[model samples]
Target: MKKLLILISILISLQVQAQRTSAPEGPGSLTFWENLSKHCGKSFEGEMLNASENDQFYGKKLVMHVRTCEDGKITVPFHVGDDHSRTWVLTMEEGNLIKLKHDHRHEDGTEDRVTQYGGLSSNTGMAKVQFFPADQETTDLIPYAATNVWWITLDDTSFTYNLRRINNNSPIIVKFDLTKEVETPPTPWGWED
Candidate 1:
């Protein structure tokens, strides 16, 4: 009876080990998405990394707030001075593809004419960087913006939002210093008052 009990104990231990090693994991690996999601509820101040003197936000206060985060999605709202109309929605698709979409709204809580435009990364970029080319939705929304390509980067010190128009010399860059968490701005335009 002692030997039988020992064998049963070994079998139970092995089963437990196998279950621990093989059980499912949460949203396998959207590393870049995961990295960005880590800053939920934090706000950071940013400036244009490379900008022309006439840039829209040249002297405006730019802030980005990682407002909401869930298992497979995150919403980051970017504020330009008092304009609270831009929110970036990032979703982790079934296969772990990261889809970025811009949700723009008016102060009165209405959708904007030129909004919901973005794309998915062509490959599985590491936690530090990811590049997304203009997707069909983008092309359909804005004809001239069909060639847009965006670069989203994050590191221990900063988070950057960069955009390039293919075959066009102009590129817009917004780099936020992540070393400090700034005061949270007002709720975005479409959110509950």
Candidate 2:
């Protein structure tokens, strides 16, 4: 009887461990764009307040729109109170890191700003954004590149984006917290259910 009880307990423990180690299904394991597609027909309203210190555009309201695309892409259109207009493309890459390409443009077709190559950190949720010189001949742009750390969290109904600008020279730290706007009618949006 003792042997049988011990065997049963060991089997139950192994089963529980297996279940715990199982991977998450659906959006959980899907690519960043694929996960965003789950929010199709939904809208996520949030503000991108400026956290830049010693800048006149501090505390400005920057609206964000996260729209789903059929080609598996999340279009994040953002405007910072007439000061800046840009769009960030978020796509999943190998090793589960999200690739980010930021394009700052004016009303015209000309490119006002460009981030030659930007991507999210592989191990962290922080954004590794960089700015390059207009001249393609240049090989390095580290002196001009700005690194920003950002954190994102999602609940069953809403999501939040917290961005902090890292100061490489000064001791002053800039931080911005943005919470999704909750619709009264409870529209389908964000990573919420």
Candidate 3:
């Protein structure tokens, strides 16, 4: 009877450990989405931390505005110097999944040729960070970006946006200071008020 009890205890311990390892961390992607939504209607200043000389945003002033936030969607406009052509649309899908899409527009309020390229969160990411691997739609929109994985990390002091491509050593990392709010820039191209 003693040996049987010991075996049962071990089995129970193993089962608890399995559950701990398999469960998503913190409140998963919903928590992350909520954390990000906390910055709605605010603007922040950022610097390109890993830009190469040839990078388009190398010498530009970077700004990001959490322009709109709704229950299931958030819209952020990323302004590079005088260019207000880039906007990020984040949508919460069913099952706690979040989709990130880039909305590029011309100065005349028309969609750019290379636009709406992004991905969906593959799993329940942590509360502070989430990874979005290139989806089939992203690959169809931009074949060369098939291996791109974009991640966003939000914390009390800073928010970071990063991108890495498989087999590439260099990554694009931009960090925005969340401690200080900046003046909201003009509306992004193709957006009103």
Candidate 4:
């Protein structure tokens, strides 16, 4: 009887573990972006300048804010220039895949440049971001734009950004790695350290 009871307990534990790791449906599917939103209140300082020029906007600081809404949409608000602020929406798609929609606009509600398609891949603590080609009608607006992938690592204190340009014809492409500075205190208002 003792051995049978032990086996039953083990089976129950295994079932619970399997459910914990199972993929959820709908809004629950965006677990990756949900985790990222936890860092919204905290600010990460980083810079992304022209890849070729490098010095044109070197040392310029940018703030990254990740906000997760109640409807399960994650918004990443990024400031590039002094007066430019862009927000990207991260949501889950049909095949358990994550999609990021870039909504770039001016302060007056005019669309500046919108790339409504982006791809996301996450495993463990690593993430990959891929920006898709712009829409057909808006091709002329963003001529120099091409699809690019960025590899990122997220941890309790900081995040790393590794950029890569993807090309089908080119044999050689460029890659750059940038680290963001994050300051997390020992304990915040509502949570324990």
Each candidate's lDDT (Cα)?
Answer: 0.80, 0.42, 0.86, 0.44
The list of candidate 2 runs beyond 4 A from truth reads: 1-35, 41-43, 47-59, 121-139, 142-151, 162-193
Report, for all candidates in order, the number of backbone clashes. Answer: 0, 0, 0, 0
lDDT of 3 by residue, 109-174 (tens): 999999999999998766667779998988998898999999887767888888877766677889
What tens digits encode model 4's per-residue C-alpha lDDT throughout 66-155?
544435466655544453445556665555555555566666656654545344543222122222233333334444444544334343
By the TM-score metric, which is better: model 3 or model 4?
Answer: 3
Residue-level lDDT of model 2, residues 10-71, one tens digit each, is 94465345435653443332432343455544444453333456654456554455644545
Q: Which stretches in model 1 have alpha-carbon errors above 4 Å?
A: 1-29
Query: What's the C-alpha lDDT at position 97 in model 3?
Result: 87
- Residues 1-193 of candidate 1: C-alpha lDDT, one tens digit per residue: 4554475359446544654564344442365576677889999999996677798888899999999898888899999999999998888776667888999999998999988999987765545666689999999999888889886877678888878786655567899999999999999998763
In candidate 3, how many Å is residue 126 off? 0.6
lDDT of 2: 0.42
Runs of candidate 3 with Cα error greater than 4 angstroms are 1-26
Alpha carbon lDDT at 177, candidate 2: 27
The lDDT leader among the candidates is: 3
Worst 10 residues of 2 by lDDT: 126-135
Candidate 3: pairs in clash: none
Q: Could you arrange the candidates by lDDT from highest to lowest?
A: 3, 1, 4, 2
Stretches of model 4 off by over 4 angstroms after superposition: 1-31, 48-56, 120-147, 167-193
Ranking by TM-score: 3, 1, 4, 2
